[model samples]
Target: MYPFLRMVKELIKFRNAPAMRVGDIHISEHRCWPWDIDLWAELNNGRTLTLYDLGRIPLAQRAGLVSVMRKNGWGMTMAGVSVRYRRRIRTFEKIEMHSRAVCWDDKFLYLEQSMWKKNGECANHALYRSAITDASGIVAPERVLSAMGHSAQSPEPADWIKRWIEADAARPWPPMQDKR
Candidate 1:
């Protein structure tokens, strides 16, 4: 189930927070609740993705993207992602999540996010490719940026993210047509 209540809490909690500059990092803290645990007694892999939303949406808000999207009838959606889970997060454990936009191209925005344990260990990290969309289909990142009152020019992407994009582009789309 989506954590709607948590999202509302985040929104209200940060309502008066200062807005962040474009490409700046947004940080937030969260706990691994009992309901967030897997049978292995650690944070569930799927739930981790959902929890990332707790940070990403606020990041968007701080960037003023959410307001622009609302005014323009645009929506944001994840087009692809790569995640690494390097450490375990036990129930009741607290973590600090950091999120930022790494770069953007004509088509999509690339974001990097991570979670760190209070003890200073990195628990997980992820790279995401997201698109802004309208009724017509995917809206160009340039257009989205312009609507948000920013210049259309994006920073150069890092080599690793460039490689990941190239790799993803080479993958076959609409995969797995054959019976298992």
Candidate 2:
């Protein structure tokens, strides 16, 4: 189930917060509720991804992208993601989630986000590729940035992210298998 209520709360809490640049980080705190736990008694992988939305959307809001999207009738969607879970988050544990836009290319925007425990350990992290779309199709990142009142020029994406992009591009679009 979608955590719409939690997302709304995040939006309201940061409504009056200052706007941020693309390079600025957006920080938020969250707890691992009982419902968020998997059978292993830790935060479920799917839930972690969903919770990451709580950070990413607010980050977009702070960067003024959300408003621009709304005015233009554009929508955002995840194109791809790479995540690493390094530690387990127990129920009732507090986590500090940090999110920021790493950079953008011709087609998509890259974002890096992490979940840090209260003890200063990184529980998990992920790199996301997101696309902004409208009635036509996927909108170029350059156009999206321009709509957000920024220059079209984008900072260089990190080497690792670039490599990941290349690797993903090389992958087959659809899988193949034969019945045994």
Candidate 3:
């Protein structure tokens, strides 16, 4: 318990660090591969940018960014994402990505990420929201509050799951464009 408390303190401090230019947070610094691009294309609905693809970048860094957060008493579960594509990237093109923890509450963690070309032009930007959850998928807000060393009580879980279900039901899959 003491170790958990200490880790939580460190994570809170790290999250509060001053925001710097996107160039400061270096990613893997590897050249974009064709396979990666193809995966990106498929996940982005054949668009230039894909949230699923970008989400995987952190994994390639070997930084264990997400795992570290989890081990340090931070619950992590994807909440929502919004990505905007600026330009198309071709195969073999060198690109860079920047990521940072923007903000968080007892229930949610927010992050901002962006991709740039060799010329330093922004190619894509994304906002990712995640929440802390226990092994049973139940969010333990009190754990976050305790970790933060805050006296305030945790709020009830938001109806996010309900909203998600409703939204999903509202948008049925489109019919197959090409029938066999």
Candidate 1 similarity to native, TM-score: 0.97
Q: Report the alpha-carbon TM-score of model 2 versus the true structure.
A: 0.97
Q: Point out where model 2 deviates above 4 Å.
A: none
Compared with the true structure, what per-residue lDDT tens digits does model 2 show for residues 1-180?
Answer: 999999999999998899999979999999999999999889999999999999999999989999999999999999999999999999999999999999888899999999999989999999999999999999999989988889947788888988999999999877676778
Alpha-carbon lDDT, every model: 0.93, 0.94, 0.50
The residue-by-residue lDDT of candidate 1 on 1-180, one tens digit each, is: 899999999888877889987789999999999999999889999999999999999999989999999999999999999999999999999999999998998789999999999989999999999999999999988888888888847888889999999999999997869687
Superposed model 3: Cα runs more than 4 Å off: 1-26, 38-75, 136-180
Residue-wise lDDT of candidate 3 within 100-125, one digit each (tens)?
A: 54544555545566777888898777
Clashing residue pairs in candidate 3 are none
Task: Give the TM-scores of the predictions, in the order they appear.
Answer: 0.97, 0.97, 0.50
Model 1 lDDT, residue 69, Cα:
93
RMSD in Å for model 2: 1.0
Error of 3 at 32 (Å): 2.2
Find the 10 residues in a row with the least total lDDT in model 2.
171-180
